[model samples]
Target: MGSTMFIELHAFSAGSHIRGTHIEASLIGLKRHALTNRYKMQTSINCARNSDKSYHEQHKVANLILPYPIEREEFCLCVFTTKHHISQHPQRGDRRSVLNDSQPDKNHKHRHLYFDEATITVSGGQGGDGEAWQTSKTKTVKNFKYKWGTNSQKFIELPAAEPADGGRGGNVYIRVDRACDSLLHIHKRKFWRAKKGYHGSSAPHSTPGRERPRLALTQEDLYISVPAGTVVRRKRSGELIADLTSHGMAILVAEGGAGGIAARPSQQMYSRRQKKEKEVSDVGLEISPRVTTSGEPGEVVTLQLLMRVVADIGIVGLPNAGKSSILKAITRATPDIASYPFTTLMPNLGVIHCERIVSEKLIDIDHETCALPVIADLPGLIKGAHKGRGLGRAFLRHLRRTRAMLIVVDASGQDPVSDYTTIREELRLYNPEYILRPHILALNKIDFEWAALRVQEIKAEVQSLEESAVGPAPIAVLPVSAVSGSGMDILISELMEAMRLCDEELSIVRGSAMDSRDKSDSI
Candidate 1:
């Protein structure tokens, strides 16, 4: 093989001094080689260029060489440039020019994607003013001396003016609609004001100013659509104003001011002698009556809106414990599924509809379907969730509004009892009263071989733990297979019964309050 020579070149700056130093070294090496070698020697030149020191200080660029060799056998030359420092080349000094040449500009703008809470001010319209007017008759004598036997009496007409009444103010309202999934639409807005009523007229010959029209009733009220589980409250007091749990729910947050009272004609009657005396004392001009009144202003209020997910039942469990699988099996919700932890990052909701069948032997009755109950699939919880571990506190709040809960546990895991205990302890630590809510324990993945024995052990452990408790009754445990669809019907039936019982209890309490009110009124 012919002898090959390797050369490495490094350039610190593009100044002439640096270039001259490298050139002198190359010349000396060539002179030394010419004295020893008799065969024709091929020469190769390599150049490396770098930017100024100020540009290099900001970004450090490593030396890079082209992979392909320059021409073979013949005199060859190669040039390499620092990729990172190329943007700051002296020839292209404009910073904007570098950006334009780097990449294609995409017209992109940020959008308000989601908003869950907001504080806003709402003011009702101001009322219009009222006006009124009156007419009077006066008699005047032109000459003091009598013409013949009787003095001549002349009648003059006088008119009095009053201000007109103002119009009624408009009210502010908040209506809930199902179309809005987030509060993003209201995020940009900070204040809402209703239209003010027209002012009353003031004229000497005009009739009582026409009553200002009711603007709030005639025109549309401010409608604010929000998700189904929005709660409105007074910002200052934090008092609950309305809970919008259904579609088309509406509430009047601020009432409009009443229109000012209309100006009425003065009813004081003056006798002929009294009028003559008053006319003589005060010039011939009549005094104008002030009967007009101003309209009242509408109410101003600051309110805060908070959104929470509404559901009849909340499904919670550890990661990969088959909570999402259960929700998918029961309802049409499709949550991402994989054999990994933290697969679910947000909550998913589904609705369940079922009919209540009546037995023919007991009585002849039509099948009555119950209201569809919503189910929320929440993110998995870990130990120390109450202390904000693994986003536990966020997931726990989703259960606060749920009427009931369904706890899912992995029966095929290493220790089913420990997993169940960990979840229970976390919930109790977050909120002591949450444990009192009606709940069902669902041991999932019974299809696995190891699940059968573990289920029995978990049931025994739960029974022992319940016996040592002093609170509500023990929660029912049911073995289920989300994959095989086994024991699903029983689970649904039990959940329906629990919700029905809760509804009955609420109705009884409401009835008692109404009865007490009636008795007090009678007394």
Candidate 2:
């Protein structure tokens, strides 16, 4: 054999086998080395040429037998092409599979950091004490001088002095913040208190009963930032405080205390009411801390904060039911997905954009006019989920704020009808009103021939309501393949329509509430 150069290829081939002296040219790419590195595997020989096909054509995957002692230019071209492809798509386990190939975490990273409910104690600041004269001092007033001679001047006496009034305390308020998505920050600390008010000082030269100093100042109110859609309520009584839904919306939870009244002079007797003065004891009532009025205590209350994830459409399904896949196919959110149950432990949010088609391309999808809907993919539910089984309470709580529901049933599962029934029952058990909400049924994993064939049967079975059915039927049932991206358009359109109807219903309810409020005000 003539003198030839050999390129020892390593274990770079993925899934495909290399037998005898022939090796498949397909490689998983150079791992942990440069371009000219040798593959630490068995040697390969023999080469097959396909000069007719392009590099990226979907013709056929043949054994890449490298012909040794070949020209340097051709050899460099093949290796470089393989390297470029590997770099561009480093996450692809299989070329035709889903875009992300990384395995999901055993315990999802987001599930641990999530915080939904918190119990907090908030109090307004205490009012500052009214100040009184600390020590007694002798004051000399000019005595009236009359006609001793014509040059004598008349004198005046000073009015009695009063103690200074105190400043008001700070208030506690809860405000909505768009940037904050979790209550974890507030959950860390259970108590929130406002700054105390500044004390007042007496003015000696002022008029009687009006000797408050000008330096006394009240504290600024304290504002706690919470994510939109947070519902505050009295912890003990369960009375609703406020539903902070919009950005910049705020409400006062606790009010500050009133300032203490200053002590009066010995000549003027102290009175409880402002109407008239009652002559009290005048013995040793000079102006001591005991004689003077003290500050009033502020209001204290314990509040329960519940965080509801606000969204337009909610995705519900059984575990490994392709809910995450549907979300990824429609929106840009990349959730951790595996072929196992409980893969998605936390909710994922995404925005659904609507665009118009013009001349075979996307056009004028103005955000202001054609507003997008924010969708959430919630965790899967099992039987008895409403009773706190498998994070059921959290999943149900998060769904309360969604405008519409998208029930995704795995068509490839043992029983798609049973899965849908379980999810619906769980929702109804948690909140009966949830059954009345608009729903869109989605039969996912229809790419398989068997699943596709059973789609109509599953839809028919779900249509015949159970004996305990309490609400309207689903708007529509669609067969979709989240992995292959088929039938997603119709499913999305149905969901958008359902969301629109829900929004209209909400607007009608709001309008009626406003009208009733106006009538009461007029009356």
Candidate 3:
């Protein structure tokens, strides 16, 4: 709430809640509806789905969320634009231009889409200034030394108190929208600012008023709400940018200024008098999102979602490495049965229910453990991924969150050595720490008759590498084919053992770190 005072009755997720307080009306006036109005803004993607043809033509507006009145469980944002939406433009030919090309291209003009620069500005409201008033009154009394008392005249000066500083401006925030319907709200407002501070009192003789500044001088407080999961980052280039990612989060975009002190009231200072003043200050808000302009048609802004799906195990392999088929076979995950590569852009999770008693044990352990070991089928990594090639870095980040990795190599082994090396290098580059985690190699496609020879070749290559290597020896490679489900039992057993090792090592490391911290604290 802003400077305006009022009782608020709000109903949250299961029940209604009410709060009664006197707030500045000005602060209330500053509040805006938290909803995004959909306007046809150029998108970020240049190509159309399944169409090579480009369009300079305009399209209907899609709805977006509006940013305002931020609070917990909600997200708010501010955006700046160099050009407004063109709602009244006439129809165009096959090749239409967003710009007014009749004249030389204005700064706002682009080929098929209007080019606009937008930024988000954020600021917190100033603090409320404290109020001061006279505490004692003056009385008149005249008295003579020897004679009776006529009455003594006593004067008391009470200094007026400065209004409380306006509440500091609300902090700027970005939230991930797990439940939010849209991000359009973020694009609605150009600036986010908190309530302003109230003014300090100028006189000391003022009457006792409300705790809030009766006069002017202090600002009210404000808040910006964002949905859960929004990544907040600073536009400024520095380490400050590093604070953005980690889960639903926010950052202090701007802080309100302190309130100014009030002046002493002009009153009789003879008898008991009030002393002290109030102070207030102002704060500014600036928030902006970086946008790239183009001469092509409107862009399609794609929010690529990266999620971790929990499972008993992850099926991972190179493109056409039978990972998709195995995921379909072992679990209910129905990934596309495609002949080409990169069919799955996102990771999918599935549960494997085994009928055997051993399977029961595995299921029980996985379900009960909050930190269950997931059998993830990580996306394929191409050579040179360690240096950020293909979908390298993104895929690697996805796997990093996983407890352990299951390397599914081709058992047909055209170059199992090279395949193994490439995968290992990428993993190391992504996180050298991951090297310590327990891992297993599954030689897939063993159903093929040549698989045995391939396995032998792989073993020889690994042995030679280990002999020449300076690091710990390589992990064991087991052959199995998803087509026939051959050797699946042995493969599963190996996985269970490897996962146990990972858990053991993890516990020791964590325990040691905790001990060190405790010692430091003790000292």
Number of the top-ranking candidate, with lDDT as the measure:
2
TM-score of 2: 0.63
Candidates' C-alpha lDDT: 0.61, 0.67, 0.44
Q: Give lDDT tens digits, candidate 3, residues 1-523.
A: 2232222211112111111111122122213212221211322212112121222122211112111112334422222121212111122211111221122221112221111112355655544443333322343333334343545334344443432222232333344434442233433343555655543332233354533333342344344444322333444432232222334454545666544232223332211022211111123322111111111111111121122333344555677777766666555567776767766655655554344414535433443453334455655677766676765665565555555556777778577777766676667767786555556677788888888667777777766765222123445677778778776666655666666676788899999999999999999
**Candidate 1 weakest lDDT stretch, 10 residues:** 104-113
| Residue-level lDDT for 50 in candidate 1 | 34
Q: What's the candidate order when arranged by decreasing lDDT?
A: 2, 1, 3
TM-score-better candidate, 1 vs 3: 1
Better of 2 and 3 by lDDT: 2
Compute the lDDT of residue 208 as modeled in candidate 2: 39
lDDT of 1: 0.61
- Report the C-alpha lDDT of model 1 over 1-523, residue by residue, as the tens digit: 2222223322212221112213334334433533443322443223343344443233332222222222223222222222111222223222211211222111111121134566777878777655443322222325545456565534323333333345566678787777776665664445666766555542223433433321212323566667877889999999999988888888888766655434444332123224434755666644333444456688888999877778889998999999999999878889888889877766788875333222212222223545757899887899899998885676687787998888899999888777877777787888877777888889999998889767778888876776224235445789999999887877776777677777887899999999999999999
- Per-candidate TM-score against the hidden true structure: 0.56, 0.63, 0.50
Residue 389: error of model 3 in Å?
Answer: 2.6
> Of 1 and 3, which scores higher on lDDT?
1
- Whole-structure CA lDDT of model 2: 0.67
Task: Pick out the ten consecutive residues of candidate 2 with the lowest summed lDDT.
Answer: 80-89
**Residue 499 error, candidate 1, Å:** 2.6
